[model samples]
Target chain A: MKLMIYAAALFAGMSLSIEGAIYGELGKSIGKLESSFYNFFVGTIILAVVLLFFGKGSLSHTFKAPKWQLTGGLLGIFYLTILIVSIPLVGVGLSMISVIVGQMIMSIVIEHKGWLGSSPSKIQKEKAAAVVLMAASLFLIF
Target chain B: MSILILAAAVIGGVLLSAQSSINGAFSKQAGTYESTFLTFASGALVLFVGILFFGQGDISAILDAPKWQLSAVWFGVGYLFLTVLAVPKIGVIATNISTVIGQLSMGILIDHYGWFGGLQIPFDWQRGVAIVLMLAALRLIYIADRKSALQKKQAA
Candidate 1:
């Protein structure tokens, strides 16, 4: 279980790095909407392929996504499009710093309240301090 | 120019993080691919709506998008899947941090090497310090988890 979690973490990181590169490149060329739309359109194709091969009967399960899941999709579009747009404008360093700061702030509320079905955990002082320090470091570097 | 760029990055980061959390919420209820597809599909829907309501509805923009730009959608799909898979196992905080660290580490390399373009940011002392701090934060989070786990084991 732990190994799977670690593997997931590694993959998550790698995915983010790829995303940063894509944003950096795409931001220079296409407008936000076009870039994002095309990206998702392509993603749909890839997902379709997976469904046809390894997915088997799993494709049907995806259509049943709840109404709230739409919110997640909307957020994905906004976040990704913005990230792509920002990379060219701001540069990756500053963009990353700002995003991390926002994330740290929001994460506290999300985790504490269990807003997203996350296992509840208190926003202890140590964690809070760590977030603050991390933010500060990001600012200094950027 | 630098200020504007930084602002964009900040906005992008916040929006992405929030969206990821929303995706996380959906992932908890639905299966991973379902959540992934819903997020992308909904995002597409929102974009289309925005084009009609606010944008000029420029078909040219969509048509003109480079082939490579379109290819990035697959990466987005993969990213969503990874997030869904990791968030539940590592918890939100850890998963987010790990990804950020991964991004920064790779981003710095990409920038320094000018892999995509001739633009490169030299790795100065400040960047090194930032990397160390990030690693330390991860360590602290890990230690906290271990402490909690040991306590539970002792109690059991």
Candidate 2:
């Protein structure tokens, strides 16, 4: 059962990678903000009915949920816009490489601090070494 | 000048991962499409509100956009579907490793030819070595994860 979980996560990750590239292309096609908006538009259309049918939605909470919950959507907007703009300027490869570096750094801090409702975990030597490799790759890619 | 672009990319990646993590949590309580729908619905609301407040409210710009731009939604939808399937099967860490692999492989080709209108950067030995090393490190992490999981299971 656990192994199945790993396989599913791997699949999800791969799909995201493809989506990341597509987002860059979309950014080039329309522009960053529009691309993001369209993504939301299309995605909403795709799932709204199904979500309703599932009877699992709690959208009413949107009104009462803390201000922070609303901020979640902002993150998506920021990420899509940034990548879309950069992908054209830096090529997808270099763009993703740099992003990975940033992600590792941010993730490390998050883990160390246990911020965002996550449990704190220490970054081991191997983890630190992985960051080194990621940095070296970014430099080489440049 | 170049570093700014890289920095932007980094920020973008961070946001992407962060959103994914949060969405994964929502997916837990709600079914796959349910969570996805709510997430995108709220995203649309947030975007429209942000656009109205921060920038010109002229959303008509999207209508003039290219087919690819419009089609980009499919990828977004596609990603949500995959994660819905993957998170339940593989967990987020393993899923992330697969994503990096998928992303970089396409990234290399796209960068090499400047496909999709991105800046052209030919892949060379320097890039080759760096990518190899990065991938190696990722693989090591995956192995370690599996080993630890196995140990925990056995102990239990």
Candidate 3:
């Protein structure tokens, strides 16, 4: 079961790479923001159709759900907008590396403190090595 | 529940990549924000309808729920938009490698800390070794990229 999970993660990782390459082309032909807009618009349509027949989740509860849950759409816009802008200025690899490193730094704190609904897990010693290694790899890439 | 979360997260990651590529191709014709807008609009439409039919939860509770949970949705779209932009500029492999590295690094931390109600998977030496391996992989990719760039320069 664990192995299967790993394989699944691997597959997910592979798709991300392909996505980046294709999006790059799209960004060039149209525009960055426009490309992102196209994705969300079309996605909404397809999902609508699927939900019509198969919907199960209480999406209606969106109102009843925590307000924090509602911010996904807004956050989505922010992330995509920035990505569109950044990829052009920096190469994909470097941009991705920066994102990863940034996430690690923030998540370390988030996890340790149990902020944002995360269960508090104390930071382990190995984390230092992980960060250092990540930094070293980023340096090499740079 | 833990296993389910694991599966969902993994599958979600893969689909996100596919979405980025598809969006990239579509954006070529549609325009950037236009494409992005369509994605969100359509998605919102679907969710709305689904909630009407399949949703058991009260729509009105959104006002009552904690404000912070709303922040959850932003990360995904951000990832998608970035992937679309990066693919064409850097090519797929380079972009993929960087994202993978970033994602895995985060994933490890999340597992270690059990963030967002995820199961806690404490970091151990085995995980440390995995990190080392990841770095090595990064080094290899970097070298390959440099070599190709150098060859292109020589040919030019």
Question: Model 1, range A102-134, lDDT digits (tens) per residue?
Answer: 666676677678775565667766667767677
Candidate 1 residue spans exceeding 4 A from truth: A1-11, A52-67, B1-8, B52-69, B80-98, B145-156
Tens-digit lDDT string for candidate 2 (A1-142): 7666555455554445456567776665555676677777778887876576764656555555445444556787777777767776777777778777777777766657876555666665676788888888887766
lDDT of 1 by residue, B2-114 (tens): 65666555656566656667765555555456556665666677777776666533446556756655555555566666876787777755776677776677766766666
Q: What lDDT score belongs to each candidate, Candidate 1 first?
A: 0.64, 0.68, 0.49
Q: Report candidate 1's fraction of native contacts.
A: 0.49
Q: Which residue runs does candidate 3 get wrong by more than 4 Å?
A: A1-5, B1-156
A1-142 in candidate 3: lDDT tens per residue?
A: 4444343344444444333334443445445454455445555655455456654444444435444433444444444444444444433443444545554455456557765455565664455455566666555433
True contacts kept of 3: 0.04
Worst 10 residues of 3 chain A by lDDT: A16-25
